[model samples]
Target: MTGAIGKPTPYIDAVQKVTGQAMYADDYKFPNMVYVSCLRSTESHAKIKSLELKKAEASPGVVAIVTGKDIPVPFGVLSISRDETAMAIEKVRYQGEIVAAVAAETIEAAEAGVKLINVEYEPLTEFFTPQDSLKTCTPDEQIHAHTKDHKNIHKTAELRFNEPEKELETAKHKQTGNFKFAGVTHGFTEPHSAVAMWNGDETLTIISATQVPHYLQKNLSKVLGLPLHKIQVKKPVLGGGFGGKSDPFPHEMIVSFLSKKIKRPVKCTFSREEVFITHHGRHPTEINMSLSCDDGGKITALDADIIIDGGAYGSFGVVTSYYNGVLLQGPYLIDKFGFRTRRTYTNKHQCGAMRGHG
Candidate 1:
C-alpha cells in the first residue's frame, strides 16, 4: 500500500500503444476472410418500397448479401427498451440507417457491391426537434411504434422531494433560466470495426473495438438465435470510446450474422463519416430551470423541466433522462427539489452516454 498510495502511475498498455504493437480489432486477419459493406438509408423517415439486390448478388467477388430480414431481432443496452435492430426492416427512422450489407473477397469489392444494390423509399413526415416529437402524430407518422399516446415520446422520468415548485413561486429571491444544448459526438480517434468468425464447432467468435463486450455478446446471441455459451466476444485494443463505443452497434451484428450465414470470417470497418453516423453520443437537451434562495444566499429550492432528443432509437436514453435532472441535486444544500425529464424520439442519429453520461 505504501508504494501504490501516492505514486504517479502510468497506463498498463502505454508502451505497447506507443510502439504500434497493439492489435486493434481491424488489425486481425484470417484465412478466407471476407469484407463487408453496408447500404444505408438516404431518407430520414421512410418505408422501404422496394429493394433490388440482383445486381449486387451477381457482382464480382461478392460472396453474399444480407438484409434486415436475415436478422430481425431487436436489442438495446437497456433491458426495458430493446428497440434497435441490426438493420432497418420495413421502414427506416433515420438517415444513414443500415438497410443491407454485402460481403465479398475484398473491401473494394464489398463497397462496389453495396453501390449496385437499388432501394426505393416512401418518405414520411420527419421530426427533427424535441418539441416536434412531443406533439401527437398519427401512428403511421410516429418514429417508433412502441411510443404511446400517438406521440414520439420515448420515456418520461420524474422525481420530486418536498414539492420544490411551490417554494419556487413564493421565494423572495428566485432565478429562472432556459437553456439549450446541441448534440455532441465523442470524436474518438478509432473508427468502429468488427470481425466475426464462424468456428468449426458451429460456434461464433467476434473481435471488436467496443467498450461493452458483455452487452455486445448478449445482443449478438439474441439477434443470431444462438446460445450465450456458443458465442464469444473479444475486445481488442480500443483507440478511444468516451462512451461512444459502448452500444452494441449494427455493424457488429451484421458481420456476425454474415459470417454465420456464409460459414466464413467477415469483417467490417467504418470510415470517419460512418463512424459519425453510427455513434450514440450526448443527447441534445433543452432545460427550463428555476432556483430559489433565501436572503442569506442559502439555496432553498430547485426545479427543472428538461426535454432531450433521443433520436431514432432508445440507446441508454431512459437512464440519461433521469440523470439530466437528478445530477442537479448536488453541490448545494437544497431542501426542496423536483425535476421532470422527457426523452423524445426524433428522425436523427441516436444519442446515449458520453464522457460524463447525461
Candidate 2:
C-alpha cells in the first residue's frame, strides 16, 4: 500500500505509555479532595421505593452524600437519548444501577459512607435474553421509559438491496449456517476513575478518564445544570480504552454532582467487579446466513438474519445493530441480498461496542 493521506504516523504517546510515570486521573490530588463510591443496586430489575442517605451523610469523616435527587438532569452520550441520570430515579433497571453515592475525607471513609446509605427496592421480573423478548411482546415490555422496544426487543430492522427470494429459488447450491459471538471486557488496569471540582463562581472542572472529553463535558453540564463554558473536562493519559471508557458512566455523573453539592473536589474509583457490573462489554450476537451459489463461479444470493443481545440499557446498542447486519456487506458480493436485524434488552451487563465492534 502506497503512502496514505498524511502518511502513517507513529504512536503519539508510545514513550509515555511505556514509562511508568505517566499521570492518570487517580494520580492527581488536591487539598480537601474527597473520594466517592457508588451505592449500586443488587437487583437486576426493581422499583426504587425509597433512598435514605441521612446515615451516609452522618457517617464518620463523611463530607457529603449524593443521590439522583441531587442531580436532576437526564444526560447520555447520544444527544438524542438523554435517558440516563446520576442515579436511578424511581427504579433500578439493572443489577449495577447506581442508587446513591457518598464522598468523604478518606477513600475508606467514602466506601463506608456508601454502605451507610440504604437503598430500598420492590423487585420486578427480569428479562434475561433476547429470545425471551421475541417470544413475549408488549407495550410494557421494556425496562426503561425511553427505549425503542416492541416487547423486550430494543431495535428491529430489515434492509434489502435486491430480490433475494427469487434469486435463491433459482440457485443451484445453497447452504445455511448459524453462529453466535461472545463479548469482551476492556480490562484497563487503571480502574474507571473520575475527578470533579467546583471552580467557584458557578463553574465546574472535571478531570475524567474518558476518550470523548467533549461529550463528557456536555453530559456534565446537563447533569449539573451548568452552562457549557462554565464546565471544563480534560482527558488525561489513558491506560487503555476499547470503547468501555468512551461513554459517560454513572460514576462520572456521581462525582460531578457530588462536587457541585459539596462545593469541593470529588472522585470515584470502581473495583474490578464494579467496572464490569456498571458498564458494558461486546454485543453478544447470533447470525443466520443463507447463501446460494450459481452453476458457474458467479454468486447468486445471500441473505442474513441477525439478533443482538443488548443488555439492560441502550448503551450503544443501536450502532451495534448496524455492525451486526452491515458487516456482512464485505469480502464477497452476491447478485441478490437481504438483511434483517434486531437488538433486545436483557437484564444483564450492557452489551456495547468493543474492539473490532462487529
lDDT by residue (95-181, candidate 2, tens digit) is: 888888778899899888888877778887778877876665554445765454347777777778779877777777888899898
TM-score of each: 0.98, 0.91
lDDT of each: 0.94, 0.79
lDDT of 1 by residue, 219-291 (tens): 9989888999999999999999999999999999999999998999999999999999986999999999999
Once superposed on the true structure, which residue ranges of model 2 sit more than 4 Å away at CA? 1-19, 137-141, 146-150
| Stretches of model 1 off by over 4 angstroms after superposition | none
RMSD of 2: 2.9
Clashes of 1: 0
lDDT of 2 at 274: 90
Which ten residues in a row are the worst by lDDT in model 1?
A: 1-10
lDDT of 2 at 323: 74
Give per-candidate clash totals. Answer: 0, 0
